[model samples]
Target chain A: MDCTIVKIGGSIIDSPEQLQRFLQDFASISGAKILVHGGGVMASRLQKALGQQPVMVDGRRVTDEQALKAVVMVYAGWCGKNIVAGLQSLGCSAIGVSGADADLIRAVRRAPVPVDYGYVGDITPESINTDFLTLLLRAGITPVFCAVTHDGCGQLLNTNADTVASCLAAALAQTGHISLTYCFEKDGVLYDKDDDSSVIPEISSGMYRSLRSEGRIAAGMIPKLDNAFAALRNGVSEITVTHARSLLSGKGTKIIL
Target chain B: MDCTIVKIGGSIIDSPEQLQRFLQDFASISGAKILVHGGGVMASRLQKALGQQPVMVDGRRVTDEQALKAVVMVYAGWCGKNIVAGLQSLGCSAIGVSGADADLIRAVRRAPVPVDYGYVGDITPESINTDFLTLLLRAGITPVFCAVTHDGCGQLLNTNADTVASCLAAALAQTGHISLTYCFEKDGVLYDKDDDSSVIPEISSGMYRSLRSEGRIAAGMIPKLDNAFAALRNGVSEITVTHARSLLSGKGTKIIL
Candidate 1:
């Protein structure tokens, strides 16, 4: 009867071992509905092997034709299925869907600006399908997601996984489910990136913004915080910023609106 | 002393026969630099044979984890080499690159909103290497690009071939190149989708947007317009939206700023 939206970041969930450990934890929440978000780190790895360099502006990927293809392989093939298999190993039924299916996320193509960034899109919230998540949850299936979305014809866009989790959690917040974000690193939400010991017990939407403004949060943490705030604004309750293991103890920075 | 960027859409360039025709034409272009964009309509057919319904949204295919793997096999192994071999047969030096090979297009990950879209990215133009393109052109080699790009840390996004062509053209536009977007269907841009004979002479940015807003342009035309506008904005000298055969006659719609 309960549901939890969880986002697994690329940094923490890097290897099979980490993923396996997370799956073991996930299996315990059998009766509870779980939604997942992952990808990015692995995508970076595979993008390198293929020899295409990635470009980013304002934290989001440019996702040109080439990078977009790489994303499809890394997110869908490598990240999404691996997590699904990991969850399946632990006896959880998992189905992976991208933004293109069911018009789940309708995004407007963002034109190249500031620097001719190509084929990027912005989320159109009105077009999101909250009901689909409910249907999946009602059916008791673990909906695992990768960061690739479609522009409604056949072109795939490379979106951030953390942002996807946050957006989904926000859309499905009305269902009264608990949302949690998981990265491989430290305890949960921390006051600083370098000092793992400075784990912040909680983060307010305003305080999180200030932290970002002060240049305290960088790398992958900014999007997580921004998405968490967005989710909170959209009515998700009890968001936890933490690692997978800490979920059991309910330990991590509690995200508050 | 002349450059042409050719974008092969999923529908028309999908078949071997269609691809061969395009390659033969490309081989015939004398003293002109060419860049080719390709996708795996064939692979999607193969994937469908395996029981996975291809997920699409707003003209973009959702290249999730599984689809990504299939595409890698299809694009790099099948489509990329297939085109390369065709070019070779025509006595042209051709080299294939996905987003992974040259750090060609850097991107960041995109997040899912309605669904767990897997592994899509946004393009970061700052990271695109025009030098690689220039070097290839200088060497008198035709660069055949698979519609896959990289996220700076090694992830790929399944991007639109039209968008890729636009990106490449925009990047190399200053060298006085003409961007030619070719698909199979008709010989030129149409005034109506139903009438293949209704060839529109030219479309300005405003006119294109108006038509799209009025629902006059949808399906395959959307990416073409999106990329055309992108190419114009990125400083491409001119863009010709037409079919493969119309290239010689300059019969397609000339997209002007």
Candidate 2:
């Protein structure tokens, strides 16, 4: 059976209705699938409530010791468990996990050079344990992962959610057909920034280059699209950028090679 | 293979050096073992930090919605992950889990009768999923559990840690010889509350009744011992109450029929 790697951003996660709808769609998938989610919006909000200032370089939060702890509590503790429980309620057997749980993903603490991204971990394709993941998938258990990873040396590192999804898709691709879906607030890669309905139906590699040159793509969408392309290059069969509530449909932008 | 169910209370968990030493000793156990931990101390501390009051009725904390969220974050998020990471550092493949993770333990929400225990969950021996747990253990993965369970219908409920351990021990007893161990602050059941060396090395059910009747046992130790005896009655072969740092030895109190 084909495996679908679906990633939901903070927008869908922050809304109960959107999350419930998304999970229902996710649970209805015919075969093996994985759901990777982002809870950064909630994490940042929580950080503020704890009187800690959130440091963001570009769109990525700088994960200091305090931020890491707070985010782990928000993401893994609240967000991940709620999702897993919701899936369980929907007759879907999903196991919530962090990288630290089973050493499922052995990541490296990102080197401090251009940015001192404290307690941030980055994983290569080598870091993914397909054998371990395959075991769970084969047992008909859906693996719902939070955006936290570990260095295999007693550190729980906060990694980017989109990156986590992309890396997982690339690594799991070694075994079978993998479709990477990026579910976000917008329906797709919008052609006009102000127009919600002006989603680009599809974007080919050549067209992506032209759009970038013309500055048509939103700045925030670049990193995610870049991740999608990276996954495609590595072996993921398809890439869809869509609204989470509208998942299980080709209602958004499809990235083509 | 004999399975050992080891439960560590809040005392050991509050100290890092002690916890590390305990985990190291726990990692060295001869056969399949499960680690169940308590985080009530930390939960209380966190509850206060969040400006919430801890309400205890008849020695059990009344789990309000706010307190339940705090404790879940403290137990399942901060406390559980650190223990799992520590075990991983010690070369043991430990997976941190909450009941919500795999539905490993399904519990009934404590009903509002004598006291309104807002979000507490209680599990019987039948509530534990042996087949699923057996799969993890057979794969050479140690299951580390936090003091959180679910209603199997989506509600994540706060559970008593000591009760969780006892119930797990008795439940797992059907498949193999199961030993239940409670590692706490004192070396064992103490003869004198203030004396470190006053460890009661052994206690029979008759002796426990006499000790309780004479007021020799501390008030806090009663419920724990009660749980231990209940596990014993339910088919658990051996129950040891010991110092977490001095585990792997008969250094604590042994409960005998």
Candidate 3:
């Protein structure tokens, strides 16, 4: 069996119209699929509204106890459920979940010796419950995941959505062909951060190093590309970075090993 | 096969220690089971924090757009996932969900003819997707549901948790024996408002009618008992109102026809 795992970033999720449009395109895709989403923008807004300061270090959120609650409320509750409802309206059977649900993705809390990202977790391919995921996929249920995980011991942890998608793809790649797609506000990984038309058609490992050395890749895209290459190495068949609306058209950057 | 459906009210959910104790007892239940939860207290606090006023009419929430968002975040996002994680820590495979997830429960938005409850939905036994639920139960996955439903058209609505439990019990009763239990702060239906030890052991329909007629029933307990009777009439094998701590003790008010 073949599976498609799409990761939508917070920018797309922040806009209702854009999200609905993306979901419409997503619903049109056939076969086993999963949607992993980021809700950082919403979470930040919620934190601000609730009198908590949103803090970030090296583009990763510093998820303190309050931030964890905000992310869980925004990501799993508001954003994830809305996406599931939207997909359902488009005739797709979508189930929204966090990694804690059914122990789908158990993560270990990151060590505090390095930057002290409170309540943040790191996951791997082995952390994913592929058997359970396979059952749902085979049963025609599309899982919509929010970027929230657990430590297997009752503690919820905030995770990066891109990492979640990559790990899920890598884990599921053991049984079937898996296609990993990163959809965000931009058309693709841009050579120039200011220019939308500067999307690199494709990038190999060597080219990625050269681009990084030349400072052509945006700061925000380095981690995403790293996750992409990791998935490729872990048996994922294909990886693409594209705009949310360009899902069906395949107009984006493809990552190759 | 027999199944237990437990509905935990907001009062119990508002206390961490009480909820943890209840989850421990719930994990000890040796059978297929489902947990439905209400987070009205949390939702109300969240609404106030977000500068939104929560209004209730006839004990039903007036779920305007903002209120709906607050409730969805608190119930489905915060409360539901935490419970799932707690149960998972206790070795119960729990999956948390809203009604929109997998289209598990589709509800109809209430009409404004009688009273306009904005974004409020009404559901029945036919609204539940029992096949998907049964599949999860057979797979040893305990579903933890939040009292949020969808209109099957990208609209999330606020629903009473008690009603959700009764409907689920009635719907699942078509295939197997179902027991519906309502867990709250008090021990059971009380003979007097101020007496915690004055639990009415059993109540028949005649006694219920007399209690209601004599103004002996509390305003809050009426709807819960009404939902219990509805479930009993709809083929549920048993119904009980018990304290959260008394889950395994069987020391509660049993409703009989």
DockQ scores for all predicted structures: 0.02, 0.72, 0.92
For model 3, what is the alpha-carbon lDDT of residue B47? 93
DockQ, candidate no. 3? 0.92
Report the number of the highest-lDDT candidate. Answer: 3
Q: What lDDT does candidate 3 reach at residue B34?
A: 98
In the order shown, the chain A TM-scores of the predictions are 0.89, 0.97, 0.99
lDDT of each: 0.65, 0.87, 0.94
- Candidate with the greatest TM-score versus the true structure: 3
Taking the tens digit of each residue's C-alpha lDDT, what string does model 2 give over A4-119?
A: 88999987899989899999999999788999999988888878877799999877789998899888887778888888888988888888888887788778999887998889
Candidate 2 ranges with C-alpha deviation above 4 Å: none
* DockQ ranking of the models: 3, 2, 1
Question: What is the per-residue lDDT of model 3 for residues A147-233, given as tens digits with 9 covering 90 to 100?
Answer: 999998999999999999999999999998999999999999888888999999999999999999999989999999999999999
Ranked by DockQ, the better of candidates 2 and 3 is 3
Q: Is model 1 an incorrect, acceptable, medium or high docking prediction? A: incorrect
Model 2 C-alpha lDDT versus the unseen true structure: 0.87
